[model samples]
Target chain A: MSVLEISELTKSYPVPGGGEPRRVTVVDVPRFVVSAGEQVALEGPSGSGKTTLLHLIAGIVAPTSGRIVVAGHDMTALGEAARDKVRARHIGYVFQTFNLLQGCTALENVAMGMAFGTGVEAGRARELLERVGLADRADFLPRQLSSGQQQRVAVARALANRPALVLADEPTGNLDRRRAREALALMREVCAESGAALLLVSHDHDILSQFGRVETMAAINRAFATADGNSPVETR
Target chain B: MSRVPHHPVALLVRRSLRQHALSSAVTMAAVALAVGLVMSVFSIKDQARNAFTGGTMGFDAVLGARGSPLQLVLNAVFHLETSPGNIPWSLYEEIRRDPRVALAVPFALGDNYHGFRLVGTTEKLFADFEYRKGRRFEVEPGGRMFDPTRREAVVGSYAARRTGLRVGSTFQPFHGLFFDPDTQHEEEFTVVGVLKPTNSPSDRVIWIPIEGVYRMEGHVLRGSGEVYTPSPHEEIPDEHKEVSAVMLKLRSPAAGMALNQTVNRQGTVATLAWPIAQVMADLFERIGWAHRILTLVAYLVVAVAAGTILASITNTINERRREFAILRALGARRRTVFGTIVAEAAALAGLGSLAGYVVYLAIVATAAVIVRAQTGVVLDVLAWHPVLVAAPAGMTLLGALAGVLPAFKAYATDVASNLAPAS
Candidate 1:
């Protein structure tokens, strides 16, 4: 069964009128799907609505039109509150800049991820941080940690609630090759270990190649990449 | 990505508060100062009232040769100042013998030591007087209870303390109505005893037998050549006798008001006054208006302090926008963020108000000894009712208002716009 299914998804923005009111089309997805337990990469050039698409899936931003079914819930049909509930229950998000809260320690950061849940998913977050090789850095504040360590903390925090779908936007964008590869592999591994599907957005082709499926966004619409990083070839 | 709180928000709040410790301290200090000012005033008033009421516990009313009600009180109850006019010994004898009068103590005042007044009244004056902490005129070592013909004297606690006079100390008291070193008479009297501390006007008095006062005056006015020691059989002349005022204890508390009116109608201008009523009126004038004015000033100060806090917090709201959005994205409700800001405001205000209350207590305590030593008025600092109400009310109100600005900002945060990618 598909973990994420998108059909005829459309999103647009209204440009404030100086002379004329015009709508800017941002994303148009005719069809998309990610099977449970699959690792997928979402790649696009600058201004390709990669972040917007990621935000739309994460329930942080409302899409103009779409039929999005994630983990059996119709995202397009849910209200803001319901979307929040769904996000809290089943979704994990990693930002491009590693938006770690500056005030909390790595462990506390991971722990707080459970605030929206019943309690700290005991051992789950600490286990994830340890898996990311920052277990010793658990007490270090986010600002005190290196960029790589911060990202690991974010990754640990993201998986704190053991969500079913992990959405990462440029998850390794700020790291060197080794750290980037380590972060990507960690995300893919955690997704599989936690029974969640991984969907990552990145501009790096090296990172893109790790995923079995790739989606490239354009101004007019979204297109899927062939496994070899070739042009879009439609699949039924 | 994780849960709300997720360590990030908590970390942020703690670090932010620590980083701005100076600001927090300043706010707290402002609150503390305001609270202290209000607390000191309330404490002093409480102390003053306690001393005043404590000095005259059992008396229902005081009657005198009426002039000023305040003067009557000052003479009959306080015994520290002159009465408006003298009531004849015959009249006092009549009141003392009346069936309606329980006990009448006559007060004669006309002399002083430095500025401290000397009151010569019968032994009944000390016997009838009550004081705080259940104290009375308990004579200590060397102090004498008035022996009418013995010419012995008892000095009040404060007077003895200030002058370092022991019981049996013999010296000629300054015989003038007010202190005059050069004009002190040659008549010598022995201090027989010292009374205990009584935080009242009585604390600074030198109580002599009413007869001693008259005799002392006679010796001075008639000169040594004309005055001689009286024989045990000879009667003191009537022309040399007088009393400043009389303190009347009626048959019952119920008869006090009626008896005071009857005493006032005795073809005399002497005014009768209730000590409690006079004290209430005095308090209204001294504390009521002053306290209201001070409280108004405090409210204004709190308003300004709150504005400064609001400005500081809201000024940082932009920097906190991303933080708010991130928390919201992590499942923080708009109301939650709003509530947090409000809570922060209340916390700051609460701390500041508490500090202010402490400051007030310190000031009152500092002033107590000096006020007592200088003016003989004891100011107590431990009174709690006003402190309890004012500190919390001031802080809560100021803090609530301060938080409203930041909470409103937090509530209005739009997640998508705040987290939007830079253009």
Candidate 2:
């Protein structure tokens, strides 16, 4: 079953007051889908709104006009509160800067994401932190850790709830190349092992080759096509 | 399959408070100072009111030669200061004989030992006077109220306690050649009674009969041949009469105004004053400037403390904004964001109020000794109520107002944008 399906997605932001209000139309998607257990990357230029589409799918940002189905739930039909509940139930976000809560230790940061889950077990949080090779640094606050270590904590937090949809927005933007590769590999392995549909947004083309599926923003918006079975150009 | 979700909002707020512990302490200190200032001022005011009321419980009016109302109350009620002029004792007797006057006690002041004043009045003075707990002077190591026929005296609580005077202790009123020369009489009076400590001015006075005071004055003049009595023990001629002030108790306190009007019309020698009204009027007049100044000072202190709290919270918001955005992204409702900030402000205010209250109590305790020495007013420093101590609700309100600017900034944060690529 498709874990996520989007049709006719559009997003517009109004320009600041000046001349006639200039509107930036970012997304004009006709159709897209990611089946369960799929690993995909959305590659685009800086202004292509790959992050925006990821946010919409994760229920953090609302789409201007579209129907989005994630994990068999029609996200567009849910109110803001219900959307939050749905996102909490299924989505895990790995922000680029690591965005680990500064005050909390690495273990605490991972456990925090599981606090709202009905079956959120502390053992799972500890196991995931151990999986990220951060078990020794579990009690160390985010500020005390190095950049790569912080990113590992973020990854641990994303997997803490064991969600079905994992969204990564430039997850390796601030990392070195080696750390970036390690993070990308770890995320891929973790998401596949957990059976989560991973939709990663990134400008780094180096991370895209490992993913089985690729969609450029323009192709996803129906502006281009390729010979592959996937409607959007795979680019490789 | 039913999927379990993460609960991030509660976790975030709890961690936020722990992370900002130092800032929270600073905010709490500010709140404490504001609360303490308000609490101290209110307590002092209440104590002062209680002391003044307790000290002047009895006494309907004071009659004397025209003078300051404060002076008149001090002389007639507290027996601490002197009246401006003397009224004839015969006039006091006339007033005492009236059906409308329940009891009239005449106070004749002209002498002092050390700095404590000596007051001469009849035994009726002690009978009419009442102190707390109904414990009067029992004259336990001394004698009783001296007979009006004898040149004997009764020592006040403080005088007897300090000077070690017992019954039959004789003291002479020896005036120096210069220095006011108010009491030049060398008449000796034996102490017949020692007053119990009343914690009022009565504790510091020496009392004798009016006739003994009159006899002493006549005896002083007799040696100089300026004035002579028929004999040393005989009463002085009526022409040499003198009484410093008269304290009159009315059958009805409500008749004070009428009594004052009637006495003011008397052609002899005396002025009438309703002491309670005069003391209130004097208090009102003095309160205008002093109360205003104290209140202004208290307000400024609280305002500054509140300003410090506001600054602390405002500075913290920038560092916390990203965290707030993370909370919003993690499914924290907008009201939750609002509530967290408000809770922080309230906590700071409550903690600060407690700190300030402690500081206030310490100050009052240290200053109480000095205050008693200087003004003879004893302030119970620890007398406080929780509701009275929490006087910074206004300061807390202002702190909340200051917190709103930051909370609004936190709530309006774009979670996706903040969590997006920095480049």
Give the top-scoring candidate (DockQ).
Answer: 2
lDDT of 2 by residue, B217-276 (tens): 443322222444435656666545656777776778657767767776643356776755
List residue ranges in candidate 1 displaced over 4 A.
A121-131, A219-236, B1-16, B36-57, B64-66, B74-91, B110-117, B131-135, B139-194, B197-201, B204-208, B211-239, B275-287, B363-380, B384-394, B420-423
What's the true lDDT of residue B350 in model 1? 76
Write down the worst ten-residue block by lDDT for model 2 chain B: B1-10
Q: TM-score for each prediction?
A: 0.82, 0.76
Candidate 1 per-residue C-alpha lDDT over A1-236 given as tens digits, one digit per residue, 9 for 90 to 100: 99888888867767665988886656678778888878888777655667667667767777788788889989889887778777766777787777776666787777666556435654676677788898788778788899988998888888887777888878888899999998888888878888888888788999999887886664225432222233222110
Write model 2 residue lDDT over A1-236, tens digit each, in one string: 89999999876667557998776555568899998989889887665657677778877778778899988888888887677777767778788888887977787777766654433576787788788888788788888999999988888888777778888889999999999999989988888889998889887879888777898876885432322323231111
* Model 1 chain B: worst 10 consecutive residues (lDDT sum): B218-227
TM-score of chain B of each: 0.79, 0.75
Best by lDDT: 2
- The docking category that best describes candidate 2 is acceptable
lDDT of 1 by residue, B122-191 (tens): 8787776544335557887645586877666788788788877668786676755567887675567678
